[model samples]
Each structure stands twice: as C-alpha cells, then as structure tokens.
Target chain A: MAKRAAFDIPDGAYVNLGIGIPELVAKYVPEGREVVYHTENGLLGMGPSPADGEGDPELINAGKRQITAVPGASYFHHADSFVMIRGGHIDICVLGAMQVSETGDLANWSTGSPDAIPAVGGAMDLVAGANAIRVVTQHCTRDGQPKLVEACSYPLTGAGVVKRVYTDLAVVDISGDGFQLVELAPGIDFEHVRDLTAAELRPLPN
Target chain B: MIDKELPTAAEAVADVFDGATVMIGGFGEAGSPIELIHALIDQGASGLTVVNNNAGSGEVGLAALLKSGRVSKLICSYPRTAGSRVFPDLYRSGRIELELVPQGTLSERIRAGGAGIPAFFTPTAVGTPLQDGKETRTFDGRDYVMEHGLTADFALVKCSRADRHGNLVYNKTARNFGPVMATAATTTIVQASEIVDIGVLDPEAVVTPGIFVSRVVGVAEPALESELVARGVSYP
Candidate 1:
C-alpha cells in the first residue's frame, strides 16, 4: 500500500505526510523526485527517519518522533509553517482517516464518540488549504465495517476535500459520479472490493 | 548594555499574578517552559486563562499546572489527548472553559497579535463548526473567516540558548510556538538551556530578538519530555 501510495506523488511537489501510515509515503518517494516534506511542527526540508542510535532528540516530525533533515533544510516558527499550508503552498497532503464520504468529505480528526479525544492538529488547515488531499486507510474497520461511506457519521475535518482514497484493498477517486474505482489490490476483484465498500462504486472503462 | 537575566524560574515568573492571561509556548512538551510552569504552579495563582497549543500531556508541564486547578480557561488548538487527563477531567466537570481554535488559526492569531494586527481573515475553518460564530467575509469570490489577534499578560517560552540581552535561539522542532509566543505577550520570560556572553552568539543566529524578551533564566538542567521519555524517565 505504501508503494502504491508513493506512485501518485508528482516530481518536485511540496508535501505534508500525516501521522501513522502516511508517514510511510516519505520513505517511498520513488528515489528520483525531490519531494519536499513539511511538518506542521516547523520543518521545511525533512529527511527520512533516523536509524537506531542515530536519532536526534530535538529534530523530530509533527508526530514527535525523531527524524533527520535533508540538506538545504530550513526551519521557521509554527505560525510560518501553517502559512505555507494555509497559503496554498503545499501541493499534496496524505492523511489517515476514520471514514471518508462518497462526496469526498474527510472525517479523520474525530469519531464524534463521547470518549474520543478531539485533537484536531492542522487537519482542518491542511484539508482546506492543500492543493490536493489523499487519504490512506484500510478498506474495512477492525470490526469489518466499510470505511468508505455514503456519508460520514463522524465529525468532518473538511467538506469535500479528499481527492483520492488509497485503501489496502483498492484505489478510489472521489469524482462527480462518486467513489470511482481506480485500481484494485492484488487478487481482489470488483465484486469483492464493492462488498467491502459502504459507498457506491463506479468503475472506469479500460 | 541592558541585562534581563533573572536568578530563578520562580523569580522569572513571580509577576504572573492571578487571573492573568498567560501564553505558554510549546507543541506538546517540546518548547514548554517546564521550570517556569512549575514555578507558576508553586506561585499558586488561580483563575488563570492559559493559551497554548495543547492543554497538557502526560502528568507534568501544563497538565500538572492545569491539574492544580489554577486554570479557569484554556484558549488552545488541540485541547485533548490520550494521556491528557487534567484537561478532560476539568472540562467534563465544567470546572474549566475552552475556546478551541484551529492550530493554524491559533498560530496566526498569536503572530498577528505580535505584529500589532487587530484581526485577519483565514480560509481554514470556513465550512466547519469552528466558524459558526466568527465573522465571515469574501475576497476574490472566496469565503474567509475572521479571527481576532490574541495577546497575553505573560508568555513563558523555552529556548536552546540565550545571551545576556535575552536574544534567543531554539533547538530544532522544539522551537514550535516559542518565537511567536515571545512576541505576543507584554512580558516574555524564557527558560534557557545555556546563558552565554553578549558577543558569543551571532546576530544572524538569533531567532527571537532581545527587544521582545523581558526575562531569561538559565535552567541548571534543561530537560525536554521527549528526551526524558527516551531515557525511560516518567514523563508527566
């Protein structure tokens, strides 16, 4: 799934990777494209995570995990980093999701459950400001419920902001027709993918 | 030459009185002025309005401060986290109030306050519940939300180093909101890892100019939660 997600990033694109699985996209930036990584905690040219015993305590990502910095790296205050995000400078943002709507609404920040912690760190800003947003998540919940829904029951991070959904099972694009099937995972058929998705699926012609 | 050095964290934050609006700089526990916060906790000032990125985490820092029942209100972005029990407990019981701002909006508001701008428009929370009561306007045919600049009576920040004049530099990501928070307050007190001579630091290396800082106290031992956690020390 990380390799599949890495294939979509264009060259020289400035990108922000959300915590969790999206962080893996940084490791698989296709070797040639100089994808500039941005962390909401105030780094511009971020490199990959450090190997064991090589980590720097102060130099970390938004996830609060230690990471390395690429050459030509520069730092700014938290405010300026958001300016890069909210001012429409970020080309792409890959985020994890609790649920994604057929209409491209993203509900990743919170589940709206009473006990859930509502930590909305830069999710709304990234969704509203980034040129494009892609969500990475499993096709089904741990309970086996579909995550691609007709409408998100959870509180939305942004309305109609998601451009694509990269699940472990399939790659779906939110379009005018809603939940267009872009590609399926290995050994998975259209019927199997459709059964796993709660939203309506429209397959594109060959 | 003007010297703004203070003897101790307690002395540095001694003037942060009750009911004061204080801006505590940090993203989680990174740039948090832990010593100053502990001093403030010892100072026992109640009904304080605190502004920060997160309410608190683990059981120390701002969380410990909030746990003391000193905070009456929290004006921040991400107010709740898994390990943040102080805020949730206080919030659920209605003992404390919250004005949850978007992270970007919070940063901009602080930056705008420091820049002397009254208010600005942002597209961040236009269609969400956060924008419900805010004044909205349109520019170039696109909708934007109005957010007022935020300032505080005192700002407590953490820095990697400081000069006698209070010029500051920060460690990597730990610099998060420290620079902006220092500027947005009437009295900015900094906790420095090392206090150097006036000519030791290059003018080009200074992130927060001395003009914005009112006090600087060198921590005998400068420790961050990330480092502490890495060392297997209990963070809270």
Candidate 2:
C-alpha cells in the first residue's frame, strides 16, 4: 500500500509522513524523485533511522524513534516547523487512519473510548494544512471490519480533508459524490474491494 | 556582569512555587530538560500545570515528574507514547487533568503567548471534537476556531550550547519548543551541555536570545532519558 501511494507523489514534493505504514512511503518513492521528508517535531529533510549503535536520542522523528538528518537538513523550533504545516507549505501529507468517511473525513486520532487516553498530536494540523492529504492503511481491521465507512464512528481528526486513500485492496479517491475507485491492487477484483467497504465504492471510470 | 548562569539544576528551579503554570520544552525526550525537571521534582512544588508536546516516555524525565505527583494538570498534544504509562495512569485515575491540544495549535499558542498575542483563530481543528465549545467564525467563507495564547510562570528548556548572557543553540531536532517556550514564560530556565563565553556563539546562529531567558545551568554530560528508562531508573 505504501509503495502504491509513493507512486502517486509528484517529484520534488515536500512530504510529511505520519508514523506507521505512511513512514515507509519515503523509502519507495521510485528512486529518481527527490522528495524532502518533513517531521512535524521540527526537522526538515529528515533521513532514515541511523545504525543501531549510532542513534542519538535527541535526533529523532515524530514517532520519537532515533533518526538521522540528511546533509541539507535544517532544524527549526516547533512554531516555524508548524508554519510549514499550518501555512499550507507542505505539498503532501500521507497519514495512517483508523477510519475514513465517504466525505473524506479522517478519524485517526481518537477512538472516543472513555477508557482510552486521547492523543491528537499533529494529525489535525497535517490534514487541515497540507495541500494534499492521503491515507495509507489496511482495507479492513484485523477482525475484518471495514475501515472505509459511510460515516466515522470515532472522533474525527479533520472533516472533509482527505483527498485519496491507498489500501491493501485498492486506491480510492474521495470525490464530491463519494469513494471513487482509482486503481485496484494487482489481481484484486472490484467486487472483492467493494465487499469490504461499508460505503459505496464507485468503479473505475472508462 | 550579565551572568544568567546557575551552578545547579536545583538552584535554577528553587524558586518555582506550587500551582505555577510551567512549560517544559521537548517533543518526546528530545530537548527535554531532564535535569531541571528532576530538580523540580526534588523541589517538591505541587499543583503544577505542565506543558510539553508529549507527556513523557517511560518512568524518567517528565514521566518521572508526573509519577512524583507534582503536576496536577498537563497541556500537551500527545500524551500516550511508547512506554508512557505515568500520564495515562494519572489521567485515568482522575488525578491529573489533561488539556489535549493539537500539535501545531499548541506550538502557535506558545508562540502567540510569547509574541504578546492574546488570541488567534486557526483552521486546524475546525469541524472536529477539538473545536467543540470554542468560538468559531468564518473569514472569506472558511471556518476557524479561536485559541487563546498560553503563557507560563516558568519554562524549563534544554539546549546544546549557551553563553553567560543566555543565548542558546540547540542540537538537531532537539530544538523543538525550547525557543518559543523560553519566550512564553516569566522565568525561562535552561540546561545546556556547554556554557560558552559571550560572543563565542555566532550572533546570527543563536536560536534563542538572552532577553527571554532567566537562568542557565550547565549539564556538560546530560543523561539520556532512553538509557535511563532502559536501565529501569526512576527519579527520586
């Protein structure tokens, strides 16, 4: 799913990847394209994880994992770093989602369970501020429940913010009408993908 | 002599009073002033309101401070992180109150507080649960939620280098929230790895100017929170 999402990113995009599968998109950006990675914790031109013994605790990503900086990387304070986000300077933001509504609403931050500790982080800012927002996730939950739904039951991170979704079954675009199929993963049929989606899935256009 | 330098972390935080709103700068453990926080822990001030990006990881640094039960309220973006049991436990038990702000909004609030802006409108959390009960207005047909500037009684920050005058330079991504938090606090205390001479630091490269900072403590070799947590070390 990550590799498929990477294929859609235009060259020279300033991209912010949310933790989890979205983080892997940087590694598969088709070699020739130069996409600068932005970590909302205040590093631009972020590099991959450092060697086992060379990790610096202070030089880490948004996920709080040790990461290296590219040679041209620049560090700024949180305000300026977020300016790149809230000011809409970020070209693309790919995030992991718990649920996405047919209207492009994103619900990745909270499950709304009273027992769960609600943590928002930068997910709302990324969805609202980035020029384009994409989500990469599994088509269904581990228990086989569809994540693409008519309406999000969880607390939303942002409303009507997602542009596209890359899942294990298909690549779907959130349009004014609803979920429009962009492309299917190899050998995945339209009916099979639609069966797993609680929302209406429009087949690919001719 | 314009010496803002202090000899110990305990001395730096000695004057912090109970019920003070303090901003502890860091995104996770990076740029976290652990020594200052530890000192604050030992200082034993209670009913404190603490601000940071994350609550803290493991039973060290901010987590350790939270575990000590000194902080009564936390203002932050994300509190549930890997190995972050302290804040969650306190929050669930209704011992600690949490004001969960979105990351960018939190940063802007600190920046605005420092810059003397009382309140600002942002489009970040509009139409979400975070926008509930906040003042909302539309400008140019786009909706926004109003957020107030957040100031603090004190700010605890960590930096890579500092001068006697309190000018600071941070290392890598560890610079998060330190500069803005320094400005947002009445007394911004800093812990630096090296305290250099004034003018030794390039004027153009200084991340935080001296006027915002109140005191500086030198921790030539600061303890890494990850290692401390790895060793199962908890604070006193």
Candidate 3:
C-alpha cells in the first residue's frame, strides 16, 4: 500500500501524511528525491523514525510517536503548520479514511459511534487544505462490510476532497459515474471487486 | 540589570485568579510546563478555561491539573493520546467541558489574538460538525468559516533558555505552542531551564521576543515526566 501511494508523490513536494496506514508512505518515498514531510505538531522536513533506544522523547510527530528531523529541518507553531496546509502550500496529503462515498466525500475522524471518543486531530485541516489528496484503507471491515459506499453514513471529515483511493483490493478514482476501477490487485478480477464493494464500480476501459 | 526572573514557580503564577482563561504550552510531554502546572495546582486556582494543544497526558502536568477538577473547560485540538485518560473520564462523568478546535485553527486563533487580528476565515472545517453555527462566507469562490482570535488572561510556557529580559529559546520540537501562546495571553509566565545573561542569547536565535513575555522563572531542574523516565527515574 505504501509503495502504491509513494508513486503518486512528486519530488520536492511538500506532503503531510495522516496517522495510521497513511504514515507508511514516508518510508516508501523514492530514495534520493526530496519529499518534505510536514507534521501538524509543527515540524517540517521530518525524517524517518528513530531506531530503538535512540528515540528522543521531545522529538515527536503529530501522532505522538518519536521521530527524527533531516538536515536543515525547521519547526514552527502548530498554527503556522496549518497555515501551510490551509493556505495550499502543501502539495499532497495522504490520509486514512473510514469511508469514502462514490462522489468523493470523506469520513475518517468518527464512525458516529455512541460510546467512542471523537478525535478530529489535523484530518479536517489537511483534507480541506491539500492541493490533492489520496486515501489509503482496507477494502472492507473485519465482518466483510464495504467501506466505499453510495454515501457516507458516518460523519464527514470533508466534502468531495478524495481524488484517489488505495485499498487492499484495488486502486480506484472518484468519477462522475461512481468509483472507477483503475487497477486491480494481482489475481483479482472485476467480479471480486464488485462483490466486495458496496458502491457501484465502473469497469476499466478496454 | 533588569531581572525578569522570579524566585519560585508559585510566585510566577501567583496572580492567576479563578475563572481565568489560560493558555498552557506543550505538545504531548515534550515542552509541557510541568513545574508551572504543579505550581498552578498548588496555588489552587479553579474554574479555569485552558487553551492548549493536547488536554494532558498521564497523571502529571496538564493531566493532573484536569484531574484536580479545578479546570472548568478545555480549549484544545487533540485531547486524547495514549496515556490520556483523565479528561475522558472527567468529560464523560460531567466534570469538565471541552471546546474542540482543529489543531491548525487553535494555533491560528491564539496567534491572531496576540497579533491584534479580531477574526479571519478559512476552509478547514466548512462542512463538518465543527463549522456548525459559525459565520461563514464565500471568498474567491470557496466557502470559508469565521474563527475568532483567542487570547487568555495568562499563558504558562516551558522554555529551554531565557535571558533576564525575558527573551527565550526552546529545545527542538518541544517549542510546539510556546512561541504563539507567549503572545496571545495577558501575562505570559515562563519556566526556563536555564537563565542566561541578556547579551549571551543571540537576537537572531530568539524564537519569542522579550516584549511578549511578562515573567521568567528560572528552574534548575525542570520537571518533565518523559525526561524523568529517560533518565531512569520511576514515576510515582
């Protein structure tokens, strides 16, 4: 999933990776190319995670995990980091989503669960601010429930912000005619994709 | 010799009355003013509305402050972390109130408050639940929600170094909300790890100028739970 998402990131682009699965994209960023990672906690030019026992308690990412900074890295206030995001200074923001509608709406912060605590974090700001966005998630829930749907039943993080979705089963793009399948996983066919998706899927062009 | 340094942390925050809005700087445990927070707890001020990045973590610092039941409301972005259980328990049990703001919005609001800007618009939370009932307008085509500038009666910050004039510098990512929060409050109190001479700190290296800071208290041993653990001190 990280390798697939990395292909979409252009060199010298300022990118913000959301927590969870989306953060894996940083490890897969093509070697020798500059992809500046912005953490909403206020560090830019973020480097890879530190090795065990070498972690600095003070050096952390927005996800509250220990990380390292690359050469010439800079830090700023949390507000300025968002200004970089909301002002469209960030080129790409890869995030994890709980649900993606056929029309490209995103719902990732909350599942509308009554007993669960809702933590918005920086998802809202990143979604609304990025010039382009890509969502990475599992195709279905543990119980075989599809995440991609006709419309999000859960609360939305943003409206019409997701452009591409990288799931376990396939890579799809939000299109006028619903989810258009771009590439299928090896050995998986259209029938398998259709069976797992709750939303209508448009077949790949011949 | 203008000495802005106070003798004690308690003395630095002595004037903080009840029902005052205070901005506490920190992102997780990095730059948390744990010593100052302990002083606030000891001073026994109540009904405070705290503006911060995270609510608090574990059973010390901000978490301990929240657990004291003295804080009436929390104005923060991310209130939940791995070790954060105090605010959740208090909030669920009707002991505390929360005003959840996006991390960026929270930063900008405090910054604007200090910079004399009343309010501004952005597209961060236009269609989400956070934007509900907020004044929004169309600018150049897209929708933007109006967020007001946030200021506090006092700001408690943690710094790595400070001169007698109150000019401060921070350590690494620990700088988090310190710079912005310093300007957004009426009385900005700092807990510095080391107090240097005025000219010792280069002007170009200062992240927050002395003009915004009202008081600086020198702390020989800044109390940080993470640092304690890193030094092999078992927390109580």
Candidate 4:
C-alpha cells in the first residue's frame, strides 16, 4: 500500500499550499467536492486555471501567479488572510520540505545561510493554524542523502507541524515512536525504502 | 508632540469608496503594513480591494480588517478558513473576495508596478489554474505570458526605522513587501516603531529612500494592537 499516489486528493477542504511542490495539489483536487482554495494573499473561492486571454491580470492566488476567481469568491486585507490561518480556519496546509524530524518539526527555511530566499514566508502562521499538515517532497537530496532525518539540522520553520509524509519513493508517518512505514512506492518494497531513509522505519500492519 | 488618542483600522477604512484598491506590503506576518490601516479604520474606509501577500492573524495585522467587515475584495495568496472567526463570518456572509497568486509573481507584479512597466512576461503561470484568462506570446521558441503590474491609491507600510524626511529602514524578514509597495502607492504613509535622526541612518541601509514616502508617523507597541488584534486597541 504505497501512500504516495498521484490521484489521492482531499475533499471539500480549505487548503493553504506552500510553494514549489504543494501547488500541484490544485490540479488533483477531488471532483464533486467544494474544495475552496485559499492563498495567503487574501483571496478565497478561487477556481482552477482559465484559458489563455481569458485570465484577468488582477486575479491570482497566494503564490502570486495569476488565477481565476471561483463564482462565490471574495477578498480582504492581506493581514486578514493570516487571521483566517492563525485563527484556525484552514484544514490542511500542504508544504514542501527541506527536512522533517521524527517529532514532526519542519525545518524548511534556512540552511544557516543569511541569504536564504524563501524565508519561511507564511509557514509559521500555517503551522500554528492548520489542524493537519501534509508534506510533499522527494525522500532524499540530490546527493542521495535522506531528507527524513532523526533530527533536523537546520532552523525550524514550524515545530511539530507535519502529520503525513508523501515522497516520491515512500509514505512515512511521524509519531513518537519514529517514521512508521504507512505505505511504499510502486516498484519498491519496505526493505528498499528503509535502506534509503535516514530515520528508523516502522513496518506497516499486514 | 506625542498623541495617545486614535481611531481603528476598520472604522477608518469604512469611509473609503466601495471599489478602492489598496496596496499593502509585507511578506507575511513579518513586514505587514498596519499603521495606515489603523487610520483607515478610524476614518471608516470601506469597500476596498487590498493587495498584499498573506493577511495577519487576529491581533497582529490585516486580520483586524477582516474581522471588522470592511474589506470587500482581496488580491493575495492566503485565504480565510472555516475556523478563522471573523474572516469565516465575512466569507459566509458573502462580503469578501479572494485571489491567490504565486509568491514570485506577486512580488514581481509589485516590483513591475514600481518600475513603471505596464506588465511583465513570465512562464510562471502556464499550466496551473493560474494561467487561465491570460495572454501569451512566443519569443525565440519560448512562451511568455503577461501578468499585470500592481498599484494602489494608498500604501501602508511599517518601518524598523525612519527619518523625518520619510526614508525607511526595515530589519530582516520585514522587508518583504515594503520597498516595492513604496513605489506603487500614490500617497505612501509610513509608521516607524522608532523615528530616527535624519543623518543617523546610513544611506546604504535605507530600503525605501525618502522620495517615495509622503507621510511619517510614530507609534508605540499598543498602536500596533489594532493592526495585530482584530478586537483592536481600546482608544479607537
């Protein structure tokens, strides 16, 4: 049971997506469910992308790229958007990851560099506000080092923020015990995934 | 002279016209423009379309405006959720508008607006729901689409330090939207936690040079409450 499926979309939930990888969730959001898309930029009720020459320059999502407004959509001060997030209105925040600790701490911002570009952005607010947080990323670095670590080496973006881990190679759940093997990627088995992971792997129930 | 009395962010904004678009700069919670927002509340400015990155939580930034039922439209990335007390109420009542954009594109639009470019070209929005309804053209076998620059009648910003002449110096994390927005607004108003001497500020450290700022005001930590807390400060 590989947890990383390209088509597993959440339903009718308001989601705040972090940059880079999480934005892909919009493309796979489930049908027949009223999943209201939110951007930290102060927009709600946003729809899927529109056809060329049909897009309004003024309309866009939190990522700051142009997007279409949903039929019932509305707007507010940029600060108000954070109110919604920090105030606990968001259900899930799908974030990309630099590293994930066994205790679910997210260290996505700095590599100890003063010049890191992303700067944790809205992640701090999302971590505090969102009831559930999911991470989408590759399991390892370019040099074949595992990103799922025993303890994050970088400054943390959010403490204990992650609930589920969906990587290209495996799906690991974070708990007090450790990285529980919830599922494995297709063409790979538990043994192979465990060998590549930095943290201890917990076997899923048969 | 130090003044203790003031209005609120919602009260000030209620007086603004129904369709007024405002530009607010801040990356996230770090650099949110809140002072002018407080004044807008006192003025009762309303029916506004605000542009910025992410709104603030209840007591700290744009969240106060959302709670007050003032802003009618938003051009930003983050949206209010079900648990967000006031924002959800507003959303449920059908009184708000939300827009989401790519973070890079949002910054670029403000920067483009500041630079006087009518619109810029980028491939950032090609495939996602972000690309719908935009114009696209090709250059050298590469496709580039147009995303319009952003501007506003009023710009509200917070500075770590400011001079009497209106130059601004912001610390790290807080520089997100201030500098570019300084150029996009017709009359930019700035609030500094500490107003500094004219010559004391190093010219190199000034993110927004004085020419871009129109008004300078100083506030203590409490004035920040309205910008931060949706319940707002007591005086307003």
Candidate 5:
C-alpha cells in the first residue's frame, strides 16, 4: 500500500520524524535498513517509542516526547544540534501538515483555530534545510474534512516544502503543476480518495 | 536610561537590528528568559531571527513575539509543542520563515559560537544532501566535515542570579541554553531571577563568565501554567 511505503524508509536515512502520525514510522520501518532517528533535544539513532514505562527518562523524539534509543545512540549539546540541521545534515524529514496546496504550498504549523496553542520550535529549519520533506497525515482531518485544498485556510509552514505526501489511503507527489496521485491503498478507489481531498489530482501513468 | 526598575534592557537590545540573529534560552516553560524577552518585546522590535530550543506556548515567552509580528524568521530545535496544540502561524500564504534545526545541532552552534571557533566539522550528515556545497574529507575511514558555528547579534539568556559584574548562575533546567547563548551572542543580555552583590555568587556556581555578558536585567518568571485542554472533547 502507498501508505505502507511511507514507513518503508530507505537505509541510512538520517530522518527527523515529527509528532503524531509521523512518529509511527519508527515502529514499522522496513528491516535491514539503517534508518537513524533524530530528536531535537539532542539524540540520534533512536529506536521505536517505548511502551509507557520502558522509555528512558532522558531520551526523546523531535517532539520532546519520551522515546527509545537504539544502540550506538549519542547525545550532544543541543545548540550544536541546530548547526547540524541548518547545515543540511538530515537526509529526510517526515512532518505532518494541515494542508497541502495543489502547487505544493504547505500550511502545517498554525491552524486557524483560535484556541490553538502557540509554538514553532525547529520546524522552520527542517522545512527549509532538510534535503527532502515528506509529509505524513490522514487524507482528511478527523472532522471528515479535506486537508488538501486549493489554498490553506489555516497557516503556511513552508512554501512548497513538501516533496511527497503519504496518507492512510494514498501517496501524492506535489510538482510544478499540482498534486499528482502516485499510488493508492489497495481496494481504495482513486475517486474516493480524490473526493476526500479538495485539491485536484491527476492519476499516475500505469 | 538609568532607573531603579527598567535596567539598560532596551538600550542594550538596540543593536539587535531588524532581522538580527539571536539565540534564546528556554524549553517549554522550563527555561524561558523573562526580562530580556520582555525588553525586546516592549521595545517593539521586528523581524528577528531567533535560534533557540523550542517554540513555547504562544502566549508564553517567545510565543508572544510571534504574536507581536516581530519574529520574521526563527531557527530552533523544536519549533512547536507537539501533540498538544498547533502554534499560531506567523507567515504569509506562500512563504514560511520558520526554520527547524535538529536539537543537538542547535545546542552545538551555541557551544561552538561561544567557544570562539568559526566552524567545526562533524560526520552527522554525511552521504546526504545535507553535506551539499561544503568542505568535506575522508577522515579515519569516515566522513567528518566542517559545519560553521553560529553567533547572533544579541543573546537573550536567563540566569538564576547575577552579580554587579554580570557574572551569572542558572537554577535547574533553566541552564539549558543560557550559558551557551551568552557566548553565542556578540552582545549578550541577561535576565536574572535575583541580583546579588559581586561577592555573593560562588565562583564555581557561575555558569556564564561575566566577561561574556554585557548587561543584566533582573526579573523572575512565573511558574509553569499546565492547564491542558483536550481538543474535540465536547462539554457534557
């Protein structure tokens, strides 16, 4: 499934996975691939998120939420950490988004929700500096609303920062013209997924 | 300029030009710099490039700057508090100015900046586009290359105490970026929870050498406000 491919992270990928859905990649990354996880608090080579009490008090993900560490993990001063990210040391960054425009404009940071809590940590650097930006999210928000829109009614996180998007139902690649449907979940129709999205989609050539 | 209350906070902040670079000290509510941040906010500054650990709750310290439209660009480790609530978006439709840095590298920049080194190399990003357009070499059968150090025009750091000479000490987790940011900024300004005499602070307890700090503004921060409101939970 295209959704599953998102977790098929390539080997030796120095990836920074965002919170929520993007965090799931740590659990199901294809075996035999040396995928390194980076957290903003200064940890790399992280393992899967531990079962509640199993997490180390010090180790965490990019979100600062408790996580697990694989062997050969190293810690360092965090100020130096940004130097690495801005210096473009990361191969891929998996982020979540509120909206992905037809032309690939991204709005993931601040939603239009008035009560939304305010913050912006290292997302700015990740979007601008990372080699490739992969977005992981449900096709539509939990409210049964389409997140892929003509324009983001919320706020923009990066301008065309997204290279590709993997949802629970489909795989989309944003390019010069608009979002191109690359793949879809097995048994899921292209129209249904396209219907769930407000943006226009062109089917990938067979 | 000289008053019992408003220390040289704003004037010292004057050199922080539009789009000036900065390294801040804070992690969530755990380690925010209260006075120095307020001094910058109160002065109505705009288009700052803040490099720090996190983008705390929007109404919290630096979050207020985002609301004030002063921060045009932000470079930090954790740009938003996760799984809690999304932050107040601060950019236009086509452009996103916030830049995310891996947490470890962010701290190292401050460490390197304060250490007076222009740049040092690390193999952390080898074989990826992250190594694009930079000097690289094979060292000891591995790739270890140079990553430049970051120094800001101004550093807004927080400390637990300060002496007349600007020597500072941090309490608990608040030390997260204070010591490093002091050295990372050309003109480092500090906000202390309390001001003691020069001889009061222990020489060993001074985390930031007074030589790196330019001015000290004294103020205490409020305790963490942990009122978590679950989203989409209907009132029954």
Candidate 6:
C-alpha cells in the first residue's frame, strides 16, 4: 500500500506523511524522485533516522523519534511550520485511516469510545489544508469489519477531504459519485474487494 | 542593563503561583525543558493550566510534572503517545481535565494570543465532534469554526543558545512551540544549553527576541528525557 501511494507522488512534491504506515511511504518514493518531507513539529527537508547511538535528543520528528536533517533542511517555529500546512503550500499528505466514507470524509483521529483519550493532533489540519490527501490502510479491520463505508461510524477528522485510498487489497478513488475502483491488488479479484467494502464500489471505467 | 539571566532554575520559577496558566514548550521531549520543569515541580505550585503538543512520554519532563499533580487542566493537541501513561491515567481517573485541540489550531491560537488577536476562524475541526458548540460562520460558502486565542501566565522553554538579552536560537526541530509560547506568556522562562555574552549571537539568526523572555537559566548539561525514561528514573 505504501509503495502504491508513493507511485502517485509527483517529483519534487513537498509531502507530509502521517505517522504509522504513511511514514513508510518515504522509503518507497521511487528512485530519483526529489521529494521534500515535512515534519509538522518544525522542520522541512526531513531526513531519515541517524545511525545507531548518533541521534540528537533535540532533533526529532513529529512522532517524537530521533531524525536527521537533510543537507538543505530548514527549521522554523510551530506557527510557520503550520502555515506551510494550513496555507496550502504542502502538495501531498499521506495518512492512515480508521474509516473512510463514500463521500471522502476521513475518520482517523478518534474512535469516540467513552473511555478513550481523544487526541486529534495534526490530522484535521492536514486534511483541511493539503492540496491532495491520500490514505493508506488495510481493507478491513482485524475483526473482519469493512473500513470503507457509506458513512463513517467513528468521529470524522475532516469532511469530504480524502482524494484516494490505497489498501492492501485494491486502490480506490473517492470520486464525486462515490468509491471508484482504480486497480485491484495481485491475486485479488474485484468481487473480493467489493465484498469487503460496505459501500458501493464502482467498477473501473471502460 | 538588559540582563534577563537568572541564577538557577528553581529561582527562575520561584514566583510561579498556584492556579497560573503555564505553557511548556515541546513536541514530545525534543524541546522539553526538563530542568525548568523539575524546578517547577520542586517549587510546589498547584492548579496550573498547562499547554503542550503531547503529554510527556515517560516518567520525566512533562510526565514528571503531570505525575506531580501540579497541573489541574491541560490544553493540548495530543496526549496519548508511546510510553505516555501519566496523562491518560489521570484523565481516566477524573483527576485531570483536558481540552483537546487540533495541532494547527492550537499553534495558531497561541500565535494569535501573542499577536494580540482575540479570536479567529479556521476550517480545521469543522463538521467534527471538536467543532461541537463552537460558533461557525460562512465565508465564500465554506464554514469555519471560531477558536479563541490562548495565553499563559508563564511559559517554560528550552533553547540551544541564548544571550544576556534573552535572544535565543534553538536546536533543529526542537524549536517547536518555544518561540510562539514565549510570545504568548506573561513571563517566559528559558533553559539554555549555553548562555553567551551580549552582541555575541548574530542578530539575523536569533529565533526568539529578548522582549518575549523574562528569565534565562543555564543548564549546560540538560538531562535527556529519553535517557531518564530508559533508566526508569523517576523525579524527586
């Protein structure tokens, strides 16, 4: 799913990858593509993790993990860092999703459980401000429930904000009409993907 | 003489009273001022309203401050993180109150507070549970929720370098909430790894000007929160 999402990123795009599977997109951005990674905690041109025992306690990513700065990296404060996000300067944002509605609403932040500690972080801002939003996740939950549904059961992070979704079983786009199947994963039939989706799965255009 | 330097961390935070609103700068532990936090803990002020991006990771820094039960309310973006049990436990037990804001909104609120803006409208959190009970207005046919500016009585931040006048330079991504929080607070206290003489730091490279800062304390060998958590060290 990460590789498939990476394929869609245009060269030289300034991208923000949400923590979890989305973070893996950085490693698969096809060779020769010069993408600048943005970590919302205040660094652009974010580099990979430093060598073992060489990490600086102060230089880390939004996930609070030690990271290195690329040669041309630039640092700013939180306000400026968020301006790049909320000002529509960021080109792409790949995020993990808990549920996606047929109309492109994203619900990745909270489960809304009575006892759960609700933490939204930057998910809302990314969805609201990024030029394009992509989600990468499993097609279904561990309990065999569909994550793609007619309406999100969980609380939404943003409304009608997602553009496309890359799942382990297939690639889908959130069209004006609804879920449009773009491609099926190898060995997985369209019927199989459709069976797992709780919403209408429009077949690829001929 | 524009000397903002203070002799010790404890002294820097000595005047913090109970029920004060304080903002501690950090995104996790990267920009966390452990020494100042430790001092705040020792100073024994209670009923603080604290703000930060995340609840502290382990039993150190912000977590230690939370564990001390000094903070009664927390205004932050995310509080649940790996190795973070302090805030969640307190929250679940109905001990600590939390006002969860979106990260960008939180940053903007602080910035607005510093810039003297009372309130602003943003598209973030619209059509979500977070937007519930908030005022909404339509602009260009798009709805935006209103968020009030946030200010604090004190701000605790960590920086890489500082001058006698309190101009600061931070280390990489650790510069997170420091600059903005410094502006939004009445008395911004900073812990610097190195305090240089006046006119030594380049004027152009300073990230935070002295006007926002009230006191600067030198913590040449600041303790790493990750190391402390790794060692299972708990604060006194």
Q: Which one wins by TM-score: 3 or 4?
A: 3
Which residue runs of candidate 2 sit more than 4 Å off their true CA positions? Answer: none
Candidate 3 residue-wise lDDT, A68-89, digit = tens:
9999899887768878998899
Over the full model, what C-alpha lDDT does candidate 2 score relative to the true structure? 0.94
Which is superior by TM-score, 5 or 6? Answer: 6
lDDT of 4 by residue, A13-115 (tens): 7877777778777766546656787877657776766698786433555554556777787654343565577567888778888899888887765585633
| lDDT by residue for model 5 (A50-145), tens | 797775433445554556667897654345456557678988888888888886767766665645433445665667567888888888988899
Return the TM-scores of chain A for each candidate in numbered order. Answer: 0.96, 0.98, 0.96, 0.90, 0.90, 0.99
Model 3 pairs in collision: none
TM-score of chain B of 4: 0.83
Candidate 1: interface RMSD in Å? 1.5
lDDT of 2 at B93: 93
lDDT of candidate 3 vs native?
0.88
Compare candidates 4 and 6 on lDDT and give the better one: 6
State each model's C-alpha RMSD to the native. 2.1, 0.9, 1.9, 17.8, 10.3, 0.9
lDDT of 1 by residue, B1-236 (tens): 69999899988988788999999988877787888888899888889999998876666778888888899999988887655567888888889888888899999999999999999999887777788888999999888899999999999999989998989999888899999999999999999999999988899889999999999999967766655534544333
Worst 10 residues of 4 chain A by lDDT: A1-10
Clashing pairs in 2: none
| Candidate achieving higher TM-score, 1 or 3 | 3
The Cα error of candidate 2 at residue B181, in Å, is 0.1
Clashes of 3: 0
| Docking quality level of the chain pair in candidate 3 | medium
Q: List-wise, what DockQ does each model earn?
A: 0.66, 0.93, 0.74, 0.03, 0.11, 0.91
CA lDDT of each prediction against the hidden true structure: 0.88, 0.94, 0.88, 0.67, 0.67, 0.94
Q: Give one digit per residue, the lDDT tens place, for model 5 in B164-195.
A: 67888765434567777888788788777788
Fraction of the native A-B contacts that model 2 recovers: 0.97
Ranking by DockQ: 2, 6, 3, 1, 5, 4
Q: How well is candidate 4 docked (DockQ)?
A: 0.03
lDDT of 2 by residue, B1-236 (tens): 89999999999999999999999998888998999999999999999999999888888889999999989999989999887789888998999999999999999999999999999999999989999899999999999999999999999999999999999999988999999999999999999999998889999999999999999999999998888988989887
